[model samples]
Target: MPRLPAPLTLPPGHDAAGATGPDPAAARDRYRALRRRRRTETATAWAFVAPSVAVIVGLAILPVIWSLLLSFQADDLVTPSRWVGLDNYRALRQDPHFSQAVGNTLKYTAMYVPLSMLLGLGLALALNRKVRFVGLYRTLFFVPFVISATAQGVLFSFILDPQFGAANSVLHHLGISQQGFLTDPGQALLVLVAISLWSGTGFCMVVYLAALQDVPASLIEAARLDGAGRRHLLRHVVLPTLAPVNVFLLVWQLIESLQVFDLVYVTTKGGPLGSTTVVVYFVWQQAFQNFTAGYGAASAYVLAVALFVIAAGARALRRRDAGSPEGAAR
Candidate 1:
């Protein structure tokens, strides 16, 4: 074996580190320069973000905090506001109308969420294939989502009108009796649910389609090679892959359904007999129409808390599911 070269030694006051290493004084200067650079970068980052942070604090956080304070007071948007802590909350439990609104909101959420998911998933699946006119079909479906809720309400009102409506005329042609869809209390809420599904499913379909497209073709081909049919592939591959998107849509649709107001406001106005009165609409009526700001704030705060709990629970379930054996396998 060849002999290695002897190690080099440095002169006094010089360290034997490497060519890349600077002298102590130079090293300290570099370190200070780096620290200054980092400080500048951080300051620049905060300067860029400050405007957005200020806007959010002013517009969103402040209002929520104010609303919380108002919830503990008695105010009608007029006269002197009186502090009546917990009274508004207590009144909520005993209010029959509030209870009814809660029931209606639950019913709407139950009907709307599943139907929207099913319809959106079905449409996404159908459109995911390499079919002609697919762009046109997607555009047509998404058009309804672009239209304002007020406009949709007006259009649906004409369609579901008992007398001289297109729907009734079509029913008449088929020799079927005319159904009072929006008029009858029994059918009104369901009719509203149907309208909402129609209006909103396009957005859900778009989201699902994007998620579906992100699925790896190689994985799907592998599954097919293993004798997997369409149902098997969907069950084992597609659904598992789309689990995160599904959770997101589930939570989003639930929240949206809970806050349903525009369609109900434009069409039913809390309806023929308060049958279609949802929590959000009820809050609107209390705060604006009935001039009970404090009680309305209390109601809104309760809803906010409920929504927070639901979101937290959903996120926990998602985390749990992600850590499961089946999720890992997928």
Candidate 2:
């Protein structure tokens, strides 16, 4: 202990404090490097999106603008050179057939959407379990959705034929008269609506099934412990969980029903006194068949606006519902 300890000394290059402060130059360099990296990432993202944006602008936006221009012009497909202002829209309002088409479209949507949703929900509820050959059942149920609408129309046309058709034959065997499925003005649209429901319900069922899978097993078990039956569980749990899916299906079905044309054209050709003629079919008739392209375009715009209003109303309802306490809890 003879020698006193030399005072501890730090190196000149090092700070006396350990890890207590940032080096400003190093931080500035890091900041600049991070900014450069972010810029590079943003540029890469835009590069990936550019092609899709270009395609959408070219195909969807350009065609919509062109159609708008055409709607204001007195132009056939052959000569789209003349301008006519709002005459086409005015003419659309005055036409009795247009009014009928509008009525038929509304009727179709009203009949089709609810029935499809109900059928789908029912089927999903019945089949949302492990069962024998469930995969096969699901496949069979979904097959119709993949079939082309035109093919479906032709198949139904033959099946609904008055003479030598299976459907009528079955009715005859059942002591029922052979009814005009597609030929009667009163029944044609209804038959089409039924067929649409049959085909579309499968898609909705699949959606519901997917949603049902996401339902909490714990909640279901609790419900069962509380002696909740199928009806009670569906009412209190499943339905609430499925509200969003139902809304989507309802809006989509309504839009699709309004735009229905292929089946009517392929099966009935809008015959039986134009009973099957929805607004879209009428638009097709005016544009392609009668050379009233401008008028047809105008009618299309009107239909688009109607769809917009319906969709907007639905969205508003959804928003209001979502803002409520019940929706928030779900």
Candidate 3:
């Protein structure tokens, strides 16, 4: 077959011969086309972003607003809803159960957050040092974090069994008496808090490890030269440097501890006279067990507002407490 004729090639003189690349007129046209194409691209990008914005507003923001409105209404699970303006809030203020749940939540936070943070920091410091099987130790510590809360709860439920528990058995071996861990109303909450600390500390340890690695060795050496011992360095140099991380861990731990439901539900079912009943569990009970959707929504919105206020306060405090790098390093 005969080959087709070669397409025409432009002559060298068709364009410029100087330092400038293209003809000025052609360059201007090309620039205009590029600007137009960029405008189109920007518009397309905004179009894509708009869908996500809409989705977030629909799924998150709208539901939150509706729940806030519902909280003020007198809507029972069985009855058709009618707005009764602030009754739910008034009821919550009067409800002993709400107060009790809040108290339990606070107790859990007070117990879990400090214990978890301290233990996590200590383990991280130890693991961060150059030691044998450091990787293995880190992995072992982190394994509990990987386990599901429900699974952990179930495991602990068996272990904390008052009559035939592994823990009680070990206590007996150590010449200690059996104690009610998840059964006694007075001690049930503490057991749950302890379980939370045990499981959560490893995750916080990983965070501290990262922050510790980021701390400058030069600063550590300078402190050492200034005759600062390990404890002094930790309190003066290391702790200050890790303040941001600590604040982050604190807020997260507080929020998670406050909302603890799954483990409590699985282990105690808010039993022994509702001693381990947290705010989230209260909400869950209202929504599912009691079938009071409006009440549940109310509880959730109230908790959300409380969280917002606390988080804002914590952030402000953190900003005020934060020192300049010079101060921290010194």
Candidate 4:
């Protein structure tokens, strides 16, 4: 073999200097250049997003902070606001209407969330099969969701009217007495719950359908080959795979149910005896109709805190589930 050339040696600060340092001035200059580039990139990014950031701060964040502050002050829109720390919250504890609204909201959420989930999941599972006209079925199911909430509320108001309405007309033919749905205090909230389910189930069904479609068929087949029944496959393979989606739907439905107002406003208007006075409706009544903006703000803050807690708890549970062995397996 030809003798290898002697290993090249370079002076300190030269290009090929291995064990020696570079020129301090050049290194400093390169470091400064990198810092300037990073600063410029950051400034450019912020400049690009400045409009959106400003809009959000002005419309969303500022309003939220203002509402929180307003909760401690008494304002009636026309008059100057006066500070009354915790008075609004304290009054809420003693206000029968407020208590009733809270109870009604909870009742609605409790009934609505589970029913919507079950009905939606059932529809999704059925439609997920290779049944005939699946596209048509999906479109029909989601049609209600596509309709605006105002339109649905108006339509249902007509359908559920005690007299001269399709629902009661069918009941009459069946020999059942015409029921006072929106008029009867006892039944108004339940009727609203039903209307909500009808209008909202389609969205939930679509979400579930998407999640179900994403479930791996191979895992399902493997489970079946290992003697797993349909229930076992669903419980073990499908549900675990769709855990994140389920949690998301649960939280979303809960929040939506809690903030229900449009249908109640259109149909019951808090009703014959405040039967359907959910918290949001109550807030509206106080802020606009009654001119007690501070009290309304306090009520809104309470609801906001409650929703935040619920969402945070659900997110934490989801995180824990994702880190578990079963979720990892999926």
Q: Which stretches of candidate 3 lie over 4 Å from their true place?
A: 1-55, 321-330
Evaluated at residue 193, the lDDT of candidate 1 is: 94
Tens digits of lDDT, candidate 3, 1-330: 999999866654364433434578778999999999999999999899999999999999998888788777766667788887767677778888888898999998999999999999999999999899999999999899989999999999999999988999999999998899999998999888888877899999999999999999999999999999989999998998887788899999988887788998899988889898889999988878887677777888788888988799887876666565553543
Least accurate 10 contiguous residues by lDDT in model 1: 13-22
Ranking by lDDT: 1, 4, 2, 3
TM-scores, all candidates, are: 0.85, 0.84, 0.83, 0.87
Q: Model 4, 1-330: lDDT tens per residue?
A: 899999877876766536666588988999999999999999999999999999999999999999999999999989999999999999999999999999999999999999999999999999999988999999998998878778888998899889878999999999999899999999998988898888789999999999999988787888889999988888878877777888899999999999998888988899889999999999999999999999999999999999999989998998898798977776
Positional deviation of residue 237's Cα in model 2 after best superposition, in angstroms: 2.4
Greater TM-score among 1 and 3 belongs to 1
Off-target runs (Cα >4 Å) in candidate 2 are 1-51
Question: Per-residue lDDT for 244-324 in model 1, tens only?
Answer: 888899999999999999999988999879999999999999999999999999999989998999899998998798699
- Model 4, which residues run further than 4 Å from truth? 1-43
Best by TM-score: 4
Model 2, 71-141: lDDT tens digits are 99887788646999999999988999999999888899889888988988888887898989888887788
Best by lDDT: 1
lDDT of 2: 0.89
- Relative to the true structure, how large is the alpha-carbon lDDT of every model? 0.92, 0.89, 0.87, 0.91
- Candidate ranking under TM-score, highest first, comes to 4, 1, 2, 3
On the 0 to 100 scale, the lDDT of residue 6 in model 4 is 100
